[model samples]
Target: MSVFQSINPYSQALIQEYPLMDTGKINAALETAANGYHIWRRMRFAERAGVLLNAAKILRAGKEKYAQLITIEMGKVLPESLGEVEKCAWVCEYYAEHGETFLADEQIIAGYQKSFVTYEPIGAVLAIMPWNFPFWQVFRYAAPTLMAGNVTLLKHAPNVSGCSLAIAEIFKAAGAPEGVFQSIIIDVDAVEKILSTPIVQAVTLTGSERAGTSVAAIAGRHVKKSLLELGGSDALIVLPDADLQKAATVALQSRLLNAGQSCIGSKRFIVVKAVLDDFMQLLLNGISQYRQGDPMETGITTGPLARPDLAANLSAQLTGSIKSGAKLEYGGRFDGCNVMPSLLMNVQPGMAAFDQETFGPLAAVVAANDEQHAIELANLSPYGLGGSVWTKDIDKGISLARQITTGAVFINSLVKSDPRLPFGGVKKSGYGRELGRHGILEFVNAKTIAAEL
Candidate 1:
């Protein structure tokens, strides 16, 4: 059997080790998930909602413990880790409160005695989650999936295996029946076998483009439904008439959040020529305040990357972009897993920093001739994830926001995911939606029932 270890990125100390589940154990989990699906699909909406609500309570009561584990395992600052846990609880409660209504039958206007479309669970769904926001990502998918009456199996990132098991326990303690939610500590090689199983109905993955493509291909070959949220080089467009201070502040906060590991975080700052210099100054001022140190320390505003390799990769991207004509305006030094918050100016379309998804605390600034050019620059990427348009004129911001092709676009605000809204991406960023009514319906069978008696 193979073993994997989780180490603190900040301290470089081993936290825990997990052994991979063998083929037999993986097969058993599949069988149990299949059985759980049968039981879960027949459960009432209220019953499932009860389980989710209980899970929310558990999450809140154990927030500190879970938050500490998140910080230790993934190197997110303690406060952010706590916020992630709270957000998980909020998602659980959100789905519990609204899932049934979201999945309720819709009346059809067909000329029959009775006609309607019913949403029903497809069966067991396999959620292949990432480690960046381990708890939030899983709950955002699982809460709605389970509340919609589908059992699920999880294949979380190896580095966050402890989080995977903890999530399984959350459901179990919340009164979920056997196998309703199982997290298997298996290697990537085992995913195909599980997906190939007849009992597995669909798959959802939140990871890199490569991983999403592979999983989508496997799901396609197996004829199972798939939803993917892949990598993004999200743009934050600052119009000439925008509030420079606010725009620069929000942009820095978004790019630096989670050490810049978020897919929705503003990776590129597209500023109009009129305010480019001013915005750059404000942005640099904000960057000067970011302090990287022990994630558990309250005074530290930034933490280490989840791994040292990520820091190295970010450094390489910076170097490539600079060679391609991007000027390093500020920090670009790396120490182990810690990357000093860096800024690159004169970033153009073809540069690595502009074109590729830089997954650390590095910010790229691109100058645009005008508003039209700003929108064009925003849409230049193959990634159509989340984006934002900043302008003092709310109406102008709204109009420009419509021009940017992405899953979600925010006007005069940072791009974020909300339970009340649908979230996903387009093009190479992956497809299908999650959250709100659209999310719960993703893995469901929308059966049209028409009858004349």
Candidate 2:
């Protein structure tokens, strides 16, 4: 297999093959990024902010083209891909507008002296991002670090190098120093050298739990910061009092968004016994209407699951679940990389799909006798990324949402990302927040200035 062949998920056609990056290039980029940080970190915040805002404009103007690359490279539906572009641009502009205030030093008084806290760029950061939400993943890490005055080097997935390079172009066009944001289009082997380098201050990754574990180990050995955003088998709970139709609709949207590729996606549906049948039937009808075909088609609600392996794994998982007593409903077959929206019922706690991340268009149905059982099922997973509870009673929903052991939980709503909120998880779902003020300080040094009297 070619290291860089572009395979169109729609037609399963080989589009093009680009050269894989070598270690030499990666080392050069690391050096350049480190040096760029020296300059970028010292530049006036207003000046850097101007560049970021300009980058945002460039992103807005080129949104279509960027979205096209995302769909072409990874097979995300065009509209959703375009939405990712817009969100990415918004994050950049958000940081440009608010980063200064967020990073501003605050003065405090010691007993007869003054002490202040100041945030500064740590240095260069290495971002190992995933193919899903390609632009959003990179920018979520990049925008905050850059706004905090750090330089960045991205080691993007090989399949989406084109998108990676496109992002670099945006920074360059925005008048950033040549190395301020560089994409090292290299293979997995090249990462170790970059991480071990003296220049790379920390590392961040948004991918699978295995990937996060690997990165965490490498960063640990190097004594560097590693912000991990890992996998999630989040719960979507529907209380007995919940509007079954609304619960089903939001569940369908939350689970199938991005073809169910997101880390914080709603994977497990925990419904109270009182409305299990209603929620199940509604879920079936709802997912059945999602047309599975070429992402470019306007009628299509779901598309191919990135690559053929994803389809194969999803199929095998669903099959095993069926053999283990779970029943498949809706669309469960895989034709190439497309595993049609699948629902599994009678899923007990021991099944892999019950706790493991299916990572595609497969949703597991777990029956809960009551709200307490719902919380128990949601907390049973090692992955604690995100979850949602549906209830007409807002107070009860909030109470139950607080019981789930996840980074984020929603009541009467599906979980999602927002620029104003901190997003991340505990447990195997990984550590560190991705957006908001807390995210900006992840790669920064919060130094204290104290006076001795």
By summed lDDT, the worst window of 10 consecutive residues in model 2 runs over 1-10
Over all chains combined, what TM-score does candidate 2 have?
0.98
Question: Which lDDT tens digits does candidate 1 get at residues 1-453?
Answer: 498789998989999999999988998999999888889889999999999999999999999999998998888899999999999999999999999899989999989999999999988999999999989999999999999999999999988988999999999999999989999998888889999998899999999999999999999999999999999999999988888898899999999999899999999999999998899999989999999889999889888999988888898999999999999999988899988889999999999999899999999999999999999999999999999999889988889888889999998888988888999999999999999989999999999999999
lDDT of each: 0.93, 0.88
For all predicted structures, in order, the TM-scores are 0.99, 0.98
* lDDT assessment of candidate 2: 0.88
Off by over 4 Å in 2: none
Q: After superposition, how far is residue 51 of candidate 2 from its true place, in Å?
A: 1.5
For this target, which candidate reaches the highest TM-score against the unseen true structure? 1
